[model samples]
Each structure stands twice: as C-alpha cells, then as structure tokens.
Target: MECWVPLFEIFLNSPCPETQASLWLQQSFNQPGPTTISTSSFLSLLTKPTHITITDSSSPSHTKRVMWIQTLPNAVQARVLSFLHYDCRRFCESELCQLAETMLKEGEKLDFWVKRAAHQLLDVVSRSNYEWFSSLNLDSEEEQVENEFRSLPDWLKDDVDETDLMLPWLPISQKQFNLAMQFSSCGENDDPMIEFEEGKREIVEQVIEEVDEVIKEVDEFLNPQVEELVERLKDRLLSLQSTSKAVELAGEIRELCKGGSQSLAILGKIEPWRADDEITSVLVSNLLDGNEDELGWRSHILCSVILPKLLVLKEPASRVLLTATIEYCKIHQRAAEYALLLPLILRTEGINSPICNVLTRIVTESLHQGHVSAFCQKLLSNEDDLKKFICLPCHQSLIGSKLVWTDSLFNLMQNILNHNIHLTQDSIDRLVQHAWESADRFSKSLKFGNFLLCFVTKCAPMLKSQKSLLTEATQHTNTLVTKSVLSKLSTL
Candidate 1:
C-alpha cells in the first residue's frame, strides 16, 4: 500500500499533461505490482522539462499541484510532499520551489502525513547541518529554533500531537525533583539543578527585547507579499474574526519572520494600532461589548497601550480619546488602570461618564491603603471642575464605608469644605446619614477626644444654621465626642 501510494503521488506531482497522467494513473491503479508505475512513467508524464503550468493564471503551478495531489493515496502523497519540500527549499530557485511550498502546506493538513513529516523535519533540524538555522543572519539561536518549529506545518505546532517537533527543554525545578525523590527509593536521582538566576523579571525582559529585535528584522523583510499577510492578520482582528487566535497566530508569525534579518526588518515596519486612536477606539468599543472572557483579554491588550498613553498624551483629542477608554474600563470593572486614570480623570470635565461611579467606588474602598487618604486630601486641595466632580462623589461614597470614614473621611471632608465648594445634594445626604447615625450611636455614650472635638469645632460655622439637625446628630455622636461637642458649643 505504501509503495503504490508513492507511485501514485509521483504521477500527481509530475507535470505530465493531466489527460495523459489521468489515463496513466487509471492503468497504474488497475495493476497490482508497485513496479508497474515506473520512473519512466513519471518522466513521461512531465509536459514541461522544468516548468509546470496549470490552467489558472493566478496560481498556475499551485492549481496544478492541488489537482495532482488529489489523485495520490494519502500516505504516498505525504512522502512525495516531504521530498518535494526538502528539495524545493534546498534549491529555492528551482521551477518547482513554488509548487513544493504549496504541496507541503497542503500535505501538512493530512493526518497520516502531518505527524510523520513533522517528526522527519524535526529530526533533520535537530540532527542535521540545516543551513536555515546555521545562517548568522538569524538573530538569536533560541529564536531560530522557535521559528523553525513554527514554520513546521500547523499540525506540527508545539502543542500538537507532534510536540516532539522540539525537544522538551524547559528547565525543571530542583525543589520539585527533590520532593519527588524523597518519596521513593527508585526515583531517578537527576542532579539537583541550581537556580539559573533567570527569574521572571529577567525572562520577561529578554522576551521583550527578543520581540523588539524580531520586529525590526521583519520590517526589512517586508515585501508586497509579507505586507499582504500582515494586512490579512490585522483585518482578521478588525473584521470580527476570532481575535485571540488571530493575535496568537500573528505573534507566532511575527517571531517566525525573525529568522532572517530581512524578515525581522519588515516586521518592525508593521505598527500595532496606536492607543486612543480611531482604530483602537473602535476595537476597544467592540471588544467591551463582547463576552466577559473576550472583554478581559481585550482589556489587557488595550491596557498595554492605552494605560501608557493616558500618562503622556497632552493633546486635547488624545485626552478625549482617553476619556472613552476610562469609561470602557469602568464598565468592564477593571481595577488595574484606576491608579493611572484616576489622576487624569480628576482633571477632566464635561465627562460625567458612568465610569466615574466605578472610580468613585474604587477611591472610597482604597482608603485602607497607607497613602490613599493623604492622596485624596491632596487632590481635594486644588478646586476645579475636575476636582469637584471627583471629590463630591468620592466623598459621598466614602461615607458609606467604615474603613474610609474612620479617619480618611474626616480629613477629606475638612479639605473639601476648606476649598469653599458647597457639597452637592449627594454629599449632604451621605453626611446627614453619617452624622445622624453617629449621634444615635456614639455622641452621648462615650467621651470624645480633642481630635474628634476639633472636627465639630471647625464645622460649627457651617452647622450653626442647622442646629436642629445638629442637635439630633449630637444625640448619637460617640459619647466622648458628645461631651466635647457640648463643651465646645458652651464655649461658642
């Protein structure tokens, strides 16, 4: 079966006229012996000595290879394809080189061929003096291995059944090995490995640098063909095709092209979409409207670029663009960017977005942080439209959380009142609720210290007109503050 399959493949791969090859293949299939389909038959099938043309002009040779490949038995077709790929790649200028690439690409999809060809190619790359990896034009040895593995047929990818496509070379931890060895006498006592000084920080930096170098190399390799590929990938992400898969594939291709300096040079020319721009704005908007998992990944991607830009874009247009992004983050419940966006949002007006509510909640909840109270106090010092919007809601929200109100709220309230901006209705409602609650619970029962007394003392001027409400609040104020309050009022 194997021998006959290869014979049939030779018929398909040959450039003999289709009519003649088909007629010959019919005869060859009817015969039982492998020798019936001879080399002479293959030689006779070629219409052109070196040039194989097909009816389609756009893909004359590719069309021919596809039509021919269909006639071979699956396994034999794969073997023929392996040899063809080896040859065409070996001699890039051969007339069959284009045909060979198409054949192997298609062959990679067939089940029987994928594993076999992958193993064969992996072995060749691992053991042989393959010039592809040997070229100094390739930047890093690790990168060369990565690309060679990637350029393998898709079925031969690292995670596929053909994972032996690259040797499993991940560094194993010594502690894990020692733990295993402690349990059994027969355990393989591999040498206890030492830490390589390669922590995540160093690895991440190296990967980033490698990626940058690869991008630069891709830019120089860019031709019309490669540009079309980049455009296709970009379009796939833009056109609502699966972005995670596409981005993943794009990342691989980006690394793959790094094999040659020319390829890497071409890649660097390919720009990722800029932050807060129309392209990314549309992307973020669509992504936020997707499912939660999709939104999460998209948020991460956007954060990489947008978070950085939020800190640097001084242009009004960019600021407006950032406002939209903050709103998106808020709607998505992403807390990662709040620290960066909070300061920027604190300065923008005409932007009463729903995100502000989320940000308000974050600020209110973050009082437990050592510096949050201090930071909020500082932000409240300079009164502006931006500060007013942030402060009013934040102060109102903070009153509801015991953690923040304990100390942070008092300090923040004093700061806001000192700015002379009348607290909004929301602020008044929360303050009234808090004061009423405090009076009912604490004002009379406990002795208040001077610090607590100082708060009421400073606020006497503002509360003088609302004595009726204050009298009710004083009833429940902490007992310590209650006496201090009474004493302070007597002095007033």
Candidate 2:
C-alpha cells in the first residue's frame, strides 16, 4: 500500500491521462527482457489492450515492468461497472458490450448484473424485464439461449405479475402464489369513481341551474297554460302551504290507512315529500303484491328501499310480510332471495314472539327451497329463538296440528343439530318440561308429546362437540400453515 501512494498521486495530479495510465502500468507490473516502444505507438497500443514493456524510474538500475489493466480482475470490474450512474453506465455499455462475455462468466449472475445496471435507468424497473428474464432457460444449449434471448423485446416489456416488488405474502407454493397475486394493475377504480362522482355532481348542478334559468324565462303573467292547468284541478291536489290544514288532512289519511300495506301505498303515492315511513310501507306492500310474474316490471327503487326496512322492523305484523313473501317465493320459486331474507328477518324478530308457526312454514318451504340449514341456524341464534319460539302460548295448538308427519319433528331436530346450533344441557330439562305442559294443555296425543320430548332432549347439549363453522375455519388455517411449512422444508 505504501509503495503505491506516490504512484497514485502521480496518476491523480497528472494533466494527461495517457501519461498517468502509462506510469500506473509501469509500477503495477514488472517483467524481464523488455523492448521499448515510442509514446504515440504506446498510446495506440493502449487503445487495443495488450502486454507492454516500460522502464521503472523509481528503481536505481532502471528495472523494466510489463504493464496491463489486469490489476482489476474480470469479476471485480463487472461489479464496479454495476454501481455506476445510469448515464455513465450506459456509456460504459456502449464501449464494453462486446467485451462483456469475455470478462464475465456466461450465467444468470453476469446477465443479472447487466440487467440490474440497465434497470436503474428506469423508474419502473420491477415492471420491466420480468417476462424476458424469467422465461429464459439459461441452462439450455447455445441455440436455445439465442432463440430465447431473441424472443425478448429489444426494449424492456412491462411486468405481467407485480408480486415480486410487493411483500412476500406469496406462499411457498408457486401455484398458490400465482393464484393469489393481487391483480391491482388494471381494475383500480377508486380514483375513477371519485372523478365520476365529481363529474356527475357538476352535471346535476348544471342541469338544475339550466332548469332554474328556463323557469325564470317563463313569464307567469303571459303563460296561460300554467294558470289554466292550476285552475282545472286545484281541488284534487293537497296544498302543503297551509300547515294546519295539511297536517290535519295527513293525520286523517294515516288513520284510514292504519290497517294494512295496500292502503299505505295509496297514501304514499298521493303525497311523497318527507314521508319515509309511508313510502316504505307502500314499497313492502308493492314488493309482496303476488306479482312473481311481474318481477321484471316491479320498481327496483321500491323493492330496494322496503325489504331492509321490513326486515329491521321486529313487529309480529312483520309475519304478514313474511307470509306474503314466502307465498310469492313459493309461487315464483324464488328460493335464493327468500332464503337470504328469511334469516335476516328471523334474526331481527328474536325469540320473544310466537314464531313457531313461521318456523314450521319455513320448514315446509325449505323442503323445496333447500336452505334449511341457514334458516334453522338463524332461528336458533337469538338466545334459543327456536326453543322459546316452539314453547309460545298462542302457537302451542294454533298450528292446526295437521301435518302428515312425512318429515317428522325428530328428523327436523336432527337436521338442526347437523347445522351445529344446539342448546345447552341446562336448557334441555326446562325445554322438555315446557313441551309436556303444552302437550297436556292443548290435549295433544301422548305419542306426539313423547316424540317431541325425545327430539328436544337429543338435540340439546348431547352433540356439543360437533364442528361449528368457526372451528372448521380455525382448523383449515392451521392445516394451510402446516402445509406451507412442509413445502418450504422440502425446498430447503
């Protein structure tokens, strides 16, 4: 290191690159039996790199040195070139692209360094070069390598998968990684939605302003059509300007329609401003108007607004809506929609009401609709909704007690258990007690009561170890993690 300090200083301080490089070479290498060459000839020779002889002035005997650029080995030179700035690196590539294969081993490591250096010039490096680099069978023969290399774009192509630059949430398995790659490149909609909303708001404002301008232009004094129209049937229209009269009229109308949905819908259509409850009542009435054939013609606005409101309302009268909806569904075979809405209604109603009749109807419906599991689970979800519902006073003998028992209550209880919604051990005795009392009070047959008692006891608490959805999901996650670990271990 000490021997090179003075020589390094000469290289740094020297005005001419040729002299500095020449002196650098002299000190770096020394060999015997050297011949002299002129300064111009030596400089020309340096352009085409080759072994050369130079006299070492620092040696007292004028010892000779054979100097070349071999101080930098092939691997280290490639590494150094990799760190250069984009513009400088590009210039180096133009000059040295031919020498690249000769200097570095022909493999991915050398190819990767070249690609990496070029990548620094592009902001979206990860997006570029993925397909070309990945598709190449570098281990293949020269002909295949050449063919593959030729297939790659002259310029870098945009990446097909963005998983590489993102966090390594991609699993150990390649198939899973490919499947789970979050396809965010094209379907991004947040900005587009915001822009669309702004545009729509602007259009709406412009339309309102244009309408106001048109209204301003209409001279009320001269526009006889407006006056004549207003005069023709002013008696039929309800004027809301007179607050006291309008309110009294509304109250009277509300009283008249207080009976049911059909009346409420008529009341809503008569006056529609600031009337949410009346409007919803009209909507539900319309939705369940036994128009399964006319679903295509039904107003989406009415259906969309009323269904949720009806479901959220916990009134026993909601049963009317439920019963109507069920009849409509059965007639239309709308099992999909009925199945989804029924559960929502049941969850809202809870177990307090006399809902056993509703459950029995649904049970009958489920025979054809095929969503028995979902409906049963929902019924039992409300702190024993099914249990308490089955024991309601009004519902005890009111169900007509007339089923043929084709699908017996025992099998129904088993189905409920299969759905993983059973009661606790403590509730079993009480439920049995309630069933027997109801059976006796209603003067039902002993045989039927005995079957009911047997069904309830078996369904509650005995099968507590049955796998619920939560337990199944937990087990599934554990299995996935174990498989992933095993995959990684095998790879290692």
The model with the greatest lDDT is: 1
Q: What is the C-alpha lDDT profile of model 2 across 244-307, one tens digit per residue?
A: 4444444444443333323323322333223344333333344332222111212222223333
Tens digits of per-residue lDDT, candidate 1, 1-492, equal: 344454455545653222223444457667875554543344233212333345666654542333344454666545544443342233223334333343346554556553444333333333334566665665687576755643535653444332211211211122322333343223255332322222432433433353334223323436687778767655554454454554454455444443344532332233333322654555445433223221123333343334434433333444445555555544433223222334334333211223333334433332222223333433333323212211112212221211222333343443333222234333444454555555543434332223245434444444555556655666556554566566655543
How many times do residue backbones clash in model 1? 39
The parts of candidate 1 lying over 4 Å away from their true place are: 1-233, 243-339, 364-368, 381-492
